[model samples]
Target: MKSFHDKVAAITGAGSGMGRELAIELAKQGCHVAISDVNENGLAETVEQLKAYSVRVTAQSLDVANREAVYAWADQVVADHGKVNLVFNNAGVALGATLEGVSYEDFEWIMNINFWGVVYGSKAFLPHLRASGDGHVINTSSVFGLFAVPGNGCYNASKFAVRGFNECLRQELELTRAPVSLTSVHPGGIKTGIAQSARMTKSLEGVLAKDEKSAKDNFDKLFITTANRAALIILKAVQGNKRRVLVGPDAKLFDVMVRMLPAAHQRLVTSAARKQAARSGV
Candidate 1:
């Protein structure tokens, strides 16, 4: 954990965003990377970019939701790289919908990837990581995981589950004195395609935006951090073995606000959501 040099890292969702940035940075530090994503083209592009570094890089097309696929991929990483030192369960998606408006299908889609994916990745690679002697697991949560938002019920549920799961895992690891450690990452908005790619409720078609592109543009404007900066913070957290990491200033502020206000914070969030809903004519 102290040094990434010559260590092997298996990263999910390495096709873009923070995952891609993490892969690039780790490669720069001489870490061999086994990167996977559902987007084959993006994964190939990431592999191409990783070639600039003098480290071995492998790309695989994977959907982290599939438990068998995740387990198989873990085996393949060890098969290809000899040993794995880090597992980054970074694959996630977004959904924009009220709890009542969100379909069971949409709920399952987000939960499968955003929450269950982390569980699969962690459970799948844990033994391999332990075998490596010095290993770490990093799971990505979000600012929404700390504070609920009206239209983000599905996403909030998934991320909050991830936070809880990783927290318990950290505690169990501590109790067992396991060689492996875990970190729960809570990132504020960053420049990523998650919002653009999010599945929005049809009920908000008129209220939010005329089209998905406009909604994405609105979201882009709100993003306060770059993916690379977030990646750097995550890597530092891994080195420091932090139990919880807030990737951006906004995330850190939100964490403190939630802790300080608690019940008052819920009222503030509800008020903001009402205002937004009113503006959207919802």
Candidate 2:
């Protein structure tokens, strides 16, 4: 965990955002990267970028929600790299809607990729990482996971579940003396294409058009952190053996608020979200 040099890292969602930046950074540090994503074009682009670094880089199309496919891919990674030192369960999507307004289809779609994908990634790569005797599981959560949001119920649910699951996994690993450790990542509004590229169903499109801020508004107001910065923070947290990682200034603020003043934090978040919803005409 001190260094990524020569280590083998398997990263889900490596096609873009923090995932892509992690792969690039790890490769620069001489770590072999196994990058997988459903976006073949973006995956190929990431692979091409990684080739400039002096490390092994493998790119593959993977749907992390597919448990069987994830297991098969993990097995192949272990076969190819001989051992897996890191598994980043970072694949996720955003679905913004009120609980009542969010469609069952949208909820299921987001859960399948965001929550279930993380579960499958963790389970699939765990054995290989354990066999290596030096491994870390980094699961992506979000600020929404820490607090309830007005129009992001589905996203919050998935991320909160991830945080709970990873916390339990960390405890079990400690009790059993497992070689692998876990870190739940809470990234606050990185400038990823998550909002622009989010899966907005027809039912939710009306709301999005009305209140959810245009992509430009999101970029300006919500997305204050860069993907590369987020990736660097993640690596540092891993090396420091942190149980939880806050990837942006906003995330750090929320972490402190929730820990130091739970009641006040809850009220503040609720009030803020209500205000946002009102502004959006939701």
Q: Each model's C-alpha lDDT?
A: 0.90, 0.86
Q: Tens digits of per-residue lDDT for model 2 on 1-282?
A: 899999999999999989999999999899999999999998988998998998888877999888899999999998888899999999998876668877788899899999999999999999988999999999999988897665577888999999999999999999999999999999998988787777544444444335334523533478899999999999999999899998899998888888898778778867775565456565
Q: Native-vs-model 2 lDDT?
A: 0.86
Instruction: Give the least accurate 10-residue stretch of model 1, judged by summed lDDT.
Output: 203-212
Candidate 1 lDDT over 177-204, as tens digits, reads 9999999999999888888787877745
Clashing pairs in 1: none
**Residue pairs with backbone atoms closer than 3 Å in model 2 (clashes):** none
| Cα misplacement distance, residue 272 of candidate 2 (Å) | 2.4
Error of 2 at 225 (Å): 0.9
* Candidate 1 TM-score, C-alpha based: 0.96
Candidate 2 matches the true fold with a TM-score of 0.93
Superposed on all Cα atoms, the candidates' RMSDs to the truth, in angstroms, are: 1.6, 2.1
